[model samples]
Target: MVSAVLLAAGQARRMGQPKQLLPLDGKPMVWQVASAACGADLLEVVAVTGAAGEDVGLALADLPLRIIHNENWSNGQASTIRLAVQSLDTRAKAVLFLLADQPLVNKALINNLVKAYRESGASLVVPRWQNQRGNPTLFDLSRWRTELLQLTGDQGARGILAAHPQCIHYVDLPGPEILLDVDTPEEYWQMQQLWQQYKVTKG
Candidate 1:
């Protein structure tokens, strides 16, 4: 089974608000990402919440998500990632880690990453659109679960990917807008502008 674990616990210190709760196309940003992940019809989709845990959970409550609350959210990104990895089903052969801020992530992009991992058997399946590399990266559980669980503070398995280039596979992402991560107020505004353009094209 291949599962998706979304990291939604960020403090968004720059944005001065929970980016997960930020509205995108009338729904919370996290909801958009979660919906896409679930819609991909993968084995499972888990959302790890920190910061505004209850609010985030409530926002995603209607969706079919396995929500996990990270008490050590203040620790940094790695904390939530490790927590999510711990909560995965033992049967999961691969896990995709998604950025909560990437609301542009859609079912098609997610399925592409998962499908590539399944057929390519790459240790890591990353998305690339032109020159941009984006998130919702997939990792073969057998290859990186140990290292993932070993992540400390804000550390992630990207270091391992950097160390071993031979095992990484790059899948062509259908859209470059999926690379937008709303870390600042300016980016959020940019996302809002891009959203309009993206939907019209998507439709």
Candidate 2:
């Protein structure tokens, strides 16, 4: 079964406050991400919280998820990732790693990724927009978990997977949603505007 891991342990140093707690369109950023991850098919959602663990936990209280605290979150992204991976259930065959700041990514995009992974037989699958790779990257648990656990720096699993280039599969993402991440107040506002525009266009 495919599982979703939401990485929410960042310090939000640049943003000056907890980015995950910041609301986008009336919902907390992390909550939005949790909803999308929970909506994926064959996925058990787990959220890794750090920085302001108490606040994040409160925000996520309504969601049904296994929350893992990254005590070493100040160590950087790699630390939180390792904590989350180590905490995953043994029954999971594949795990999709997603970022909390990506509130713009929706349920449909995550479902597409899980569906493609099941059908494509790829060891590592990432959503590709133009030439840039984006979030919600999936790693086949049977193959990549050990190597992923060995990762130490803040780069996450990209460098390890890149070493085995042939094993990577790129699914062309339908929109810029894959590339958008709200890191700052300005970016959040821009995303809100973009979301409104998108809703209007779709309607």
Candidate 3:
């Protein structure tokens, strides 16, 4: 079975506020991502909180999922990833790593990744847009759990991907949502504008 890990522990130093709490269509950014993860065909969805643990928890209170708080969040993304990996269900065959700020991720993309992983049997599976790798990458626990446990610093799974290129499988998908993340105030504002346009177009 596949499990999803929503990483929501970043300090948001550039935006000067918790990006996870930022509103996207009247819901918290992390909530939107977690909601999608919950809707996906996965065995479990785990939300990892760090700097904004209390607020993030409150944001995702109603979601039927597991929440984990990482005390060593200041150590960087690696700590949050490790925390989620450790908290994952032992029955999980693979774990999907998701970012809280990527509000555009949806259940379809997640399901597609899982489908690819099941068929390809690759050690790692990730979405790629125009040759650029994106967020919400999946790793086979039986294959890479040891490597992931040894990771440190801000680098999430990039090191592992670099070290084992042959084992990586990319699922080509359209759109910049997989790569676009809200990091700074300007970027957040841009995302807000894009979201507004998207709503208008959809309606």
Candidate 4:
């Protein structure tokens, strides 16, 4: 089973506020990301909340998934990741990690990565657009479980990807907007614009 993990624990120091609760398409940003995870082909969907844990919880309360609050969230992304890994379902053979800030992450993208993880023998299945690696990466838990647990402060799974180039299976996406993430106010605005474009195109 491939489990979907939505990492919604960032403090958003650059945005000067909790970006998780920010509105996107009439729902919270984290909600949209988690929704995509739930819509994916994964068996289990887990969301790790931090910073504005309570508010984020309320936003995601109606979703069909489990919530994990990380008290040590302030420490960094690594702590939240570790907590997420520790709570994975025993049957999960691969874990797809999604970022809450990337509201543009849709079900199709996630499903595509999961499909890659299943078909490719590589340890990692990542999205790339014009050579730029993107979020919602799928890691073969059976292979990278130790590396993920060993992650340190502010560190993410990128370290493992960088260390083992041959083990990565890159799925090139059509455009870069599909891989965009919100960090600063300007980035959020740009993402909102992209969201509008997507809505119209898919409408």
Give each model's clash number.
0, 0, 0, 0
User: Which runs of model 2 end up more than 4 angstroms from their true locations?
Assistant: 201-203
- 178 Cα displacement, candidate 3 (Å): 3.7
lDDT winner, 2 or 3: 3
Candidate 3 — what's its lDDT?
A: 0.91
Tens digit per residue, CA lDDT, model 4, 37-87: 888899899999989999998999999999999999988899888999999
The lDDT of each candidate is 0.88, 0.84, 0.91, 0.90
Write model 1 residue lDDT over 34-153, tens digit each, in one string.
Answer: 999989958999999999999999999999889999999999888888898889988899999988899888998888888888788788999989867668788888878888888887
- lDDT of the structure predicted as candidate 4: 0.90
Cα lDDT, model 2, residue 159: 85
Better of 1 and 4 by lDDT: 4
**Model 1 deviation from native, Cα RMSD in Å:** 1.2
TM-score on alpha carbons, each prediction: 0.96, 0.94, 0.96, 0.98
Instruction: Give the per-residue lDDT digits (tens) of candidate 2, residues 37-143.
Output: 77768558889999999999889999888898988888878888788788888898899998998887778888888888889999888888888878889999899
What does the lDDT read for residue 133 in candidate 1?
Answer: 64
List runs of model 3 lying over 4 Å from the truth.
200-203
- The 10-residue segment of model 1 with minimum total lDDT is 153-162
